[model samples]
Target: MKVAMVASHYPLPSHREEFVARVHQVADAFRRTPGCLTADCWLSADGDAVVSTVHWESEAARDASLATVMTAGLDIGYDERESRPREILHLVAR
Candidate 1:
C-alpha cells in the first residue's frame, strides 16, 4: 500500500525560505529509507503548506514510514484529518 500525506500548515508566522529549508531536509529522509520505493514532496506554490506521497513495499512498511515522518514535527493535522492509504494501480517506467 502507498500513503499520500498532505500536511497543511495553518499560516505560520515564520519566513518562507526558512520553512522550506526545514521541510526539504525532512523530506529527504523519506527518499533514503529502506523499503521505500518512491518518495516525493512539494510545497504549495502559495507557500502555505507541503505534501508528500510515499510508496512502500507493504502496508506495514507504509505505516512505519508515516509514523517516522510525523515524528519529525511537520505541521500536519494528524488528529484533524484521517490518514489515507491506497493500493498502487500502476507504475510507468522508461
Candidate 2:
C-alpha cells in the first residue's frame, strides 16, 4: 500500500531559511530514489515550522530509504530547540 511520511520541525527564526534549504535538498534526492512517489517541503504560514511529506510506493520502501536518505548530509542544527521533538505521522488512505 502507498504510504505518506509526514514530519514537522520547529526551527529558530534565524535557522528557518537554512533549514528549509537543507530539507529541499533531501526532498530532491528522494525524488530520484526508487519507490519514492514524490517528496515535498513547505514552511508554515508564520514561518515557525518546516513540514515535509514524502510519499512512497510502500511502507517497506520508506523504511528502506531511511538508511540512505537520512544520511544524505543534513544535520539537525543547534538553533533547533532540543525541547521540541519533531512531530511525525505515517498515513494510509482509508
Candidate 3:
C-alpha cells in the first residue's frame, strides 16, 4: 500500500533539512508501530510545498500506521489542503 502526503507552508522551505531530520526521528520513534516500510520526502523548487510518500507492506499495515500517525498528532494543515488521488496515467516508456 502506498500513501502520499502533501503539505505547504510559508516557511517550510527554509527548514527543509530540519523537517526531514525530524521526520526520520518520528519514524524511528514509531519503529515498533508496524506498517511503515519507508518514508521519502520531496520539496518544490519554490520552497513552499512538500510532498512525501510512504509505502507499507500491506493495506492493514497502512491503516495501522495511519492510526499511529493520528495518535501522534501528525497533522499539517495547508493554507490549502486537498485529499485526492494523484492520477498517474503512464509509467516509464522503457
Candidate 4:
C-alpha cells in the first residue's frame, strides 16, 4: 500500500526563505528517488512555516528512502533553522 509522509516545520524568523528553499530542494531530491511517487513543499501564508508531503510506494520503501537520505545528509537543515523540532505524520490512502 502507498504511504504519505507529512512534515511541518517552523523556521526561525530570519531563516524562513532559506528554509523553504532547502525544503524545495529536499522535495526535488525525494522525487527522483526510487519508490517515491510525488513530493511537494508548501509555505505558510504568514511565511513562518513550511510543510512537505511525500508519497511513497510503501511504508518499507519510505523507511528505506529516509535512511538513505539521512545517511547522505540530504536534508533541509531543520536542526539549525527551525525554532523547534519538526512534526512528522504518516498516513495511508483511504
Candidate 5:
C-alpha cells in the first residue's frame, strides 16, 4: 500500500527561515529517492509552523529512505533549533 508521512516543525523565531530551507532540502532529497512518489514542504495555515508531506511507494520504502537520508547527514537537528519537538504522522490511502 502507498503511504504518506507528514511532519510539522515549529522552529524558534530566529531559525524559521533556516528550518524551512532545511525541510525543503529534505523534501528534495526524498523526491530523488527510489521509492518516493512525491514530496513537498508548506507553511501551516496559521503560519506558525512548517510542514513536510512525503508520499512513498510503501511504508517500508519510507523507512528505508529515512534511514538512508539521516545517515547521509540530512538531519537538520530540529530538536536543537525548534521551539518544541517536531510532530510526525503516518497515513495510508483509503
Candidate 6:
C-alpha cells in the first residue's frame, strides 16, 4: 500500500534557515531512495516551522528506507536546532 509520512519541526528562530537547508538536502537524498515516490519540504508562513511530506511505494519500503537513512546518520539533527522534538504522522492511501 502507498504510504505518506509527514514530519514537522519547530526550529529556533536563529536556526530556521540552516534547518530548512538541511531538510532540503535530506529530502533530496530521500527522493533518490528506492520506492520513494516523492519528497517535499515546506516552510510555515510564520517562519518557525518546517514540514516534510514523503510518499512511498509501500510501508515496508518506507520502513526500510528510514532504517537505512537512520543507520547512515543522514537523519538531520532536528533536535539540535528545534525548540521541541519533531512530530511525525504516517497514513495509508485509502
What is the per-residue lDDT of model 6 for residues 1-94, given as tens digits with 9 covering 90 to 100? 9999999999899988888888888788778789999999999888778999999999988988787666666647656668998899998998
lDDT of 1 by residue, 3-93 (tens): 3444443235344455456556666776666667776656677755544555667666666776787686665433322223212333322
lDDT of 6: 0.85
What lDDT, from 0 to 1, does candidate 4 have?
Answer: 0.84
Ranking by lDDT: 5, 6, 4, 2, 1, 3
Query: How many residue pairs clash (N, CA or C atoms closer than 3 angstroms) in each of the candidate models, in the order given?
Result: 0, 0, 0, 0, 0, 0
Off by over 4 Å in 1: 11-13, 67-94
TM-score of 6: 0.90
**What digit string (tens of lDDT, one per residue) describes model 5 on residues 2-64?**
999889999888988888899998988888888999999999878789999999999889898
- Candidate 4's TM-score reads 0.87
Evaluate all candidate structures by whole-model CA lDDT and list the values in order: 0.54, 0.80, 0.51, 0.84, 0.87, 0.85
**lDDT (0-100) at residue 21 of candidate 1?**
60
Q: What is the TM-score of each predicted model, taking all chains together? A: 0.53, 0.85, 0.50, 0.87, 0.90, 0.90
Supply the TM-score for candidate 1. 0.53
After superposition of all CA atoms, the RMSD between model 6 and the true structure is 1.4
| Model 6 clashes, total count | 0
58 Cα displacement, candidate 3 (Å): 0.7
Sort by TM-score, best first: what order? Answer: 5, 6, 4, 2, 1, 3
lDDT pick, better of 1 and 5: 5
- Cα error, candidate 3, residue 53 (Å): 1.2
| Candidate 1 lowest-lDDT run of ten | 79-88
Which is the leading candidate under lDDT? 5
Worst 10 residues of 4 by lDDT: 69-78
lDDT score at residue 3, model 6, on the 0-100 scale: 98
Q: Report the Cα lDDT for candidate 3.
A: 0.51
Tens-digit per-residue lDDT, 1-94, candidate 2: 9989888988767777778887888888888778899999998888777998999998888887766787777673444342267898989855
RMSD to truth, every model: 6.9, 2.2, 6.4, 1.6, 1.2, 1.4
Residue 23 lDDT, candidate 2, scale 0-100: 82
Pick by lDDT: 2 or 5, better one? 5
